[model samples]
Target: MSMQLNYNWLLVLLSYAVSVLGSFTALQLAVAIPLAATQRQKTAAVVMAGGAMGLGAIWAMHFIAMLACDNGMDVSYDASLTALSALVAFAACVAGLMLVGSGRFDWLRLLAAGICMGLGVAAMHYIGMAAMMMPAKISYASGLVALSVVIAMVASTVALWLAFNLRGPLQMIGSALVMGVAVCGMHYTGMAAASFEDNGGQLPDGYAEGLRGGNLGLTIFVVVTILLVLMLVLHYWRQRYRSSISI
Candidate 1:
């Protein structure tokens, strides 16, 4: 039997919102990574920026997307696994930045960084999927799964390139849009790969009821909003300091 899937349009829209926000934040961090590498004192800042991108963009986007999915079965999540998935996403972002932003730009480095970042994203997705404590057996279509990985790797590579090369506000905005699409594409495609089977069983102990889609969406909105504000403040402060030093 064909697997049935239902999506809440509102949640789906929210997922897109998170994607865009995350993409912009990531691009900002990508631009900062190389600059930070030039100054050892900024190393900690780079990591913080990377963590923000990973947590806000990659991990949050995935979580919101997952909440958008409905399979007509009782579903919840394991709290610990859910939290761990965020850490995985953060680590992936930091690794990607460190690899590509080491002040040694090269094709090989780009490729390796892209692969690592892509795989990191895929790992976070699957890990988050595993966090779902539903009474259904989940399976994936091998072909779609492979396609999703390819998309993630290629998109990540291109995004990193743009971050390193692009300049000006318009270029940044354009890059962010492209990256947002790529991130969302990888996510929904991965979602397409998933197929669920109801096993007629109950969730195991320690499984907390999942947040309602609406609730999750609202929470993500608040979190992303706060992060964006912080990013803007940091950006402004950095620019101001640079201006002062130039004088």
Candidate 2:
């Protein structure tokens, strides 16, 4: 028998929304990274902001997308692995931000930063997949995985370039939209790369057995919404303070 993957379209749409919101916030933070008054402040801001972006954009988006997936089997996740995957995502985002925001705008640096960011995003995806504790063994197509990584790298490079080069609200909005599409594209492509084999194994204890797709989606939605609001408030406050100081 052939295995089929089913997805809840509603949840998939919600995942995309989460991605967009995360990308927008990340872009805003990226733009602000270079504007810090001091080197220490810039580094700290980049790490914190990058972690927040990774949490919402990469980690949360991946989780929500997984929630949308159904392989006609009972699926749960290893709590520790899941949490660790988020940390990995945050670290990757921080590395990417640091590389791009390092006060140097060169092709080599951009390429290096893009590759690092791409690999980080891809690593987060695969790691999160590993966290799934289902009664099956998971595998991947090598080609699709490579393609997804390429998409992530290219998109990440573009996003970083836009973050560094673009000015004003309209440009930022456009960059966010494009970056969101890139993030979603990489995710779905990675999903396409995955296949499961029934191993007749049992799910382990202490996994995320109680969480369902809808419930997880609702939780992510609420969390991301709150984060977005907080980010906006911080951005505006920072802007106002900077304006006052410049006078």
Candidate 3:
């Protein structure tokens, strides 16, 4: 009995690990490639396409895990749901672009890159988490192992992308910051999406809550003000310096 129990536990651990890792890898593909796209748009597009396909791959892997563990995973919906989710995710990406563009940050270019990456991560997490359901009949623990793997893979990919693509100290720092935001966004979104639907979780609801919180709007206004002031000061200073050199 003892030996049998240990063998069963081992299978559980291994299966959990594999599924989580695959999911995390899916997240990485979503986040890193979008940020990298700013530098290599064509290459980035290819990466994005790969990421879309990866969704299916990860889902298949998760299904396999469920089968192995007798957890009973099924997708009762059609591919249209997947496509709809992808469209929603892309809309989030466009919103990120608009937000970054509206604010005049000291590092606007870098900020845009980071925001896009972060949004991608967030979209991937929530979308992936919302993709399936656990049968009320099967008493299996949530695949947190799979979720962790997805996050770690994403972080590592972002780090690698930054190391290879970003140049200059400031740019590197900006890229890192962006990737960090992406990771955080991804985690929260994934958690939210994975939560029980009846447990009061909706993406639009979260967005509205953030906006009504006032903090976000104030923070954006303050940053924009600071950036404007800095730009004015820099312009005058540059002119003075040039005038002196000419004289």
Candidate 4:
């Protein structure tokens, strides 16, 4: 039997909102990379930006979207795989940000960075998907899977371009919006790629010990709260710095 999958629309919206907030925060940090006079400052900015994008925008949003999914089964996540997915997301974002943030921005760098970030997002999504533990076996359609990856790469490229190459408020706002598209589009598309089949009600090993929806919900709440506070801090810091510079 094939499991009928559905989603909570509100949680889906919340996932997108989290993605935008994370993107805005990351891009705000990213715009300062070129202005960093020291290698340490540049490295710090890159790492921070990477964390925001990877952990906050990509990983957190992925899980929230997962929570929004109701696959008509009792599902839990493998803690180890879940953690690995997050690390992958963080590492990929860091590499992409570092590549584009260093030296002069060029087309080649942007292309490479986009590929890195896009593939990272895709990989994180699938890996996170793999973390699901239920009485069903999952599979993907090759066509939609490929489409999801392409959507990620193309939109991620566009988002990075908007993030680093834009001016004033548009710099943060535009990239964040497009990046939300990159994150959410790839996600739902990937979800569309998946088909779940029943396995005679046989649950995977350790399903009893896996992280449940309640656990994930609490984690996501904390993450969103942190992201909101970070955005506010960034806003305040930017305002004060601008005022001081103009004085």
Ranking by TM-score: 2, 4, 1, 3
Which 10-residue window in model 3 sums to the lowest lDDT?
A: 1-10
Q: Mind giving the per-residue lDDT tens digits that candidate 4 earns over 7-62?
A: 88878888898889888887777776787779998898788778888888888889
Worst 10 residues of 1 by lDDT: 205-214
Better of 1 and 3 by TM-score: 1
Give the runs in model 2 whose Cα sits over 4 Å from its true position. Answer: 205-213
Total backbone collisions, model 2: 0
Where in model 3 is the C-alpha error above 4 Å?
1-78, 86-107, 133-247
lDDT of 3 by residue, 1-247 (tens): 0011011234333333333333233333333333442546534533442332232222222222222222122222223444455454444333333343233423545444444544454444444444443322112124653564356345534533443354454664455355444444334324332322222222332232221221322333334334434533553575489679979
Task: Tell me the tens digit of each residue's lDDT in model 1 across 1-247.
Answer: 3449998788777776766766676676556666663566456655765676678767887888788788886677777788888888888877877888776899899899889988988888889898888777889999999999999889778877776787677887777777778888998999899988876676666656554444865688678868876886787688789879989
Top of the candidates by lDDT:
4
TM-score, structure 3 vs. true? 0.31
| TM-score on alpha carbons, each prediction | 0.92, 0.93, 0.31, 0.92
* lDDT by candidate, in order shown: 0.77, 0.81, 0.37, 0.85
- Model 1 segments beyond 4 Å from truth? 1-3, 37-39, 209-214
lDDT of 2 by residue, 1-247 (tens): 2358999888788787777778777777777787887899889778766865688877888888898898988777777778888888888888888987887688888889888988888888888888888777788899999999999889878877876787787877777777778888999999999888787766656555534454877688778768876986797798799899989
Over the full model, what C-alpha lDDT does candidate 3 score relative to the true structure? Answer: 0.37
RMSD to native for every prediction? 2.0, 1.8, 17.8, 2.0
TM-score, predicted candidate 2 vs. hidden true structure = 0.93
